[model samples]
Target: MSNGTDMALISELVARERLFRARHNPEIRDCYYADATVATSWQQGPLSTFIGAESKEVDPRFVIVGSVSTPVVHLNGDKAYVELPTTTHMRMMVNGTLAELESYRRLIYRVERRDTKWKISRLTSINESDNLRPVIVGQDLHVIPQDFNGLRSSYQFLAYVRQAAGGQISQDLLGTDRPEEVERLYKETNAWLRAGV
Candidate 1:
């Protein structure tokens, strides 16, 4: 398939993910292959568990804000491998208070062409950082963040790469030219994760 075709399929997948998060619609699973496997940083086992969390009855207001960056797609016959950067902000109300959490993830989706449609067969989420706090209205309360040492390793690797490039890394490579900004982001992410929300 052409790159354009691959990207279109990825775009559809992203849109489906946003729809699922916004509406907690179980029918959204139709976007995935029947035996799709999903691995995320926060949970183990089936992707159903993650999707089911949204279906649980709750009174507190829940919101999910997400974005998917341009994906690198490689098409091989009937299969395609897509890698993209994603950011998500999840907010919920608890005991009349509001809490928000942010996470950065590198998502890899294995897409396969079934007949004339493309379906996601496998998804692997590489958690870059978790526990980012979003500005929330009213009282400030959050969940205890989980410790992910990979954040430190990622930071160190970026720093090394920047140094190797004579202290000048392209924004395209680092996502931002400022190394301090990356450190600050990771710090905030770690704090949010430690908050456990």
Candidate 2:
């Protein structure tokens, strides 16, 4: 049911997932930049600031557990593309409560051989969506997990608004306003999270 190369790619993906589980923020930082192009999405100023603020509040001990069920591999000459099309279950303790999320991520890993060693040239997260509830209130309050879920379910209906308007709307409406966009994305993403893939 699989080829040797397929097995190798799966092994690579598994290794990366393990690193994520290690929850070593520094390692994640390094892994994120193992290649220049791979880190482009993260270099955005506001995104950087967001990460900086979140990292301070998030404990490295938080655990994320998940699995890879279906993997699609495509090879183009020297470049190989791998897509993980399976459901993943990730749970981590946030603010003293275990917050769980289910989502699917499609990732691409590029490999090259130099001398006798095979080196990963680049790894790109092509697309990823998670179905996790929003942690904060409508961009205003910092609520614990229990509180977040309680209120979130009541207003979960707002997600359709974000999905219909798209991220660009949130950007335009909340432009230059850090808190506004953060709240918009949080709400939009929550709507998708509640949708459940």
Off by over 4 Å in 1: 1-3, 52-61, 92-97, 134-197
lDDT of 1 by residue, 94-176 (tens): 32445455657677677777787888877766546545333464454432333222224323333222233245322222223
For candidate 1, the 10 contiguous residues with the lowest summed lDDT are: 168-177
Provide the overall lDDT of each model, using Cα atoms, as 2-decimal numbers.
0.56, 0.39
CA deviation > 4 Å runs, candidate 2: 1-59, 86-98, 133-197
Please report the candidate that would top TM-score against the real structure. Answer: 1
List, residue by residue over 54-155, the lDDT tens digit for candidate 2: 323122354545566455554433334444444445444333444444545444444433343334444443223445543443332233345333222312
**Clashing pairs in model 2, backbone N/Cα/C closer than 3 A:** 131-193
**lDDT for position 154 in model 1:** 28
